[model samples]
Target chain A: MTYCVGVSLDAGLVLTSDSRTNAGIDNVSTYSKMYQCETTPDRFLVILSAGNLATTQAVIQQVKRDVHEGKPRNINNMAYLADVADYLGEILVNLIRKHNEQGGFIADATLVLGGQIKGREPNLYMIYPQGNYITSSSETPYLQIGESKYGKPVLDRFITRDASLEDAAICSLISMDSTMKSNASVGPPIEVLIYKRDQFTTPKHYKFDAEDPYLLAIRQEWAHHLNQAFRSMPRLEESQAQPNSYLRAL
Target chain B: MTYCVGVSLDAGLVLTSDSRTNAGIDNVSTYSKMYQCETTPDRFLVILSAGNLATTQAVIQQVKRDVHEGKPRNINNMAYLADVADYLGEILVNLIRKHNEQGGFIADATLVLGGQIKGREPNLYMIYPQGNYITSSSETPYLQIGESKYGKPVLDRFITRDASLEDAAICSLISMDSTMKSNASVGPPIEVLIYKRDQFTTPKHYKFDAEDPYLLAIRQEWAHHLNQAFRSMPRLEESQAQPNSYLRAL
Candidate 1:
């Protein structure tokens, strides 16, 4: 299992991914799910991937190989980031179809493609297994794939495109922390890459191992504050009734 | 789509459910998912249900009919709450199979059954559609059904066996609020039932409609605190590097 989230803030874009992949409880492995795709000064692109490891790896390899071989439609020369997303989706769906046809196995994967092209604003797109993709909306400026539910409430409450890059990065870690606490299949060495809206050089990337200081501090801080917050949450105004007995259903 | 959670604290049990049911986005309806089995001063059982509404209603109707007709294995006669959970699971699986054999549609549902019998300690069990059930453990003393993931993080953070009944009820509401925020399908009126330990009479039930004042109060309070908590969370100490330049992946 995997948990990857990409948030597009007005200041920048932040993408986060967990490293744990498991076929079953006993068959767990760690692999980086974040890839920098053909970055240069004017244009920068990064991909956060989830789902079948083989399919995602294959898609990444194809992208790199396409760039190396100077394919006509490689990420290097795409006019817009969405076109790169569409290219990635096509490669992914074709590979999935090949695997399904050959072995009757499902080889599905999803990707988050985001970055800036020289003239366009920084944007994010979530590619589906069906060779289609969607960008984040202004209201919900974050896109999540794989193990999303555990962390969605955090993003729903905190993520806004107008927020700062630092705030988005911190919130993504908190979201990852919440997901890791509730699910064993998604574990650490978390990776976060932040891209400033227009400075299209190598994006800021931070990798947090299981015992990273910032990770541990925020985890403890979040948990402690959550407990305190729960205490401060509103209490019910019990109606006048007999004490020490269960009040009848009303 | 539904969200129902049952928390078994040392103080007793608290069960909560939303009243929204939908076949699709266009065919949504309101229906209560909480049901009370035949209860006496000595025994109490409440069920929070999820899944196919028809199947759940059938299971509830069968339980009522069996108790009404004086069945040997009815809730009123069961010595242990686990026995009642098992009985409910049996009726559910049988009805599902009958429906499948007749029309070939999947009639699956899940239930959280919690309360106490005179001779047994207070217990909670989650009955699956396959006719098997599992109870809460000492470490994780809550079971949830239908659209459970959005609400699990709060339960994971705050629910413990030693929690006060008031704490448990408030935490459950926060969990529900999180779910409703993320999912339009899981809406109000929210129903909550609190069962104090060793008190087997009708449990204290509170219903919060969309505009309920206390509900509005906690929702606003929680959102405000969450924003405050995020600001207080740790910030990264970025290394000395070129200003406005993306940091390289490390």
Candidate 2:
């Protein structure tokens, strides 16, 4: 299981992912799920993956190989960000199909692609295992893949197009923290990348292991704040008599 | 789709459920999912249900009929609370099997049963569609059924055997509110029932329609507090340079 989230903001793009991977309880391992490619000085791209480990690794290796081999349709030479998304989608579909024919196992994988070209705006796309992809809109500025439900309410409440890249990254970490607390399959070291629009170079990156002091501080502070917030909310007993009022009227 | 939660506390038990039911998008309707039966003056029971509506309705009707007919092994005649759980489990499994044989449609339902009989402590059980059931523990004093994930985090943080019944009820309401915000399939009028320890007759019940003033007040106040809490948490930029310090040292 994995949890990867990418937010496209007016200031830039923020992407975060958990590093835990497991085939079963006994087969748990940790691996980096964030891939960064400076396809060219003008073109920078990041890929965050979830689902089948073998399939995602193969897809990443193929993408790197295409750039090295100077293939006709590689990320380096793609004309638009959407074209890069389409290229990744094609690679994913072909790999899954090849594996499905070899035996009877699921080879599905999901991915998020976010980056910018020199003259164009930064963009974010979520590529499905079936080789289809959808981009984020102004109304919905973020996209998530894998173990999404536990962390979604916070994003729905706080994420907006106007949020700063730093704020978006903070919200993403909070989201990942909530998921890790609820699910054992998603763990650290957490990887986060923040890209300022049009920079087209390696983005600001940070990794936090399970015992990292800063991560622990954030977790503790968030929990404290949440408990305080809950306590401050109006109590149910204060409102209980309102429902009974109608009964009294009858 | 539905969301129902039951919590067992030192003071008593708290159960909350949403009222929405739907066969398809066009066929949405509202029906109470909370059922209470006082089989005898000393024995009280409450059942909260989710899953296929027809299957749940049939199971509830059968239980009512058995009580009316004075069946030899009915809920009214059960000796222990566990026996009542077993009885409900048996009825659920038999009904699902009978319907599955009629055609090729699923007839699955999940339920949470909570109550107390005189001379026994209050308790809670979750009955699965496969004719098995599990009870809540002191460490984990709550049981949930139907679209449960969205509402789980708060309960994981706040619920304990030491919590007052009113506090448990408030937490349950917050959990249901979170679920309703995240899932359109689980709507309201919401139903909540709070039972005091050793009381065998009617529990305190409250029904909140979508436009209920108290429900709206809680929702608005909770959201405002959450936003404030998020803003108060420490920012990521304050911790950004620590990761770089290690990299520079290396």
**Candidate 1: tens digits of C-alpha lDDT, residues B1-250:** 9999998987899999999999989999988898877555689888888999889988888888787888887778878888898999999899999999998998899999998988779999999999999999999899999999999999998888999988888899999999999999999989888888888875788888899888899899999988889999988777512243332232
Candidate 1 colliding pairs, count = 0
Query: Alpha-carbon error at A82 in model 1, in Å?
Result: 1.7
The alpha-carbon deviation from the true structure for residue B249 of candidate 2, after best TM-score superposition, in angstroms, is 22
Q: Residue B171 CA error for candidate 2 (Å)?
A: 1.1
* TM-scores, one per candidate: 0.95, 0.95
Name the regions of candidate 2 deviating beyond 4 angstroms.
A238-250, B238-250
lDDT of 2: 0.86
Clashes of each: 0, 0
Tens digits of lDDT, candidate 2, B74-144: 88877788999999999999999999999777789999999888889989999999989999999989999
Alpha-carbon lDDT of model 1: 0.87
True contacts kept of 1: 0.50
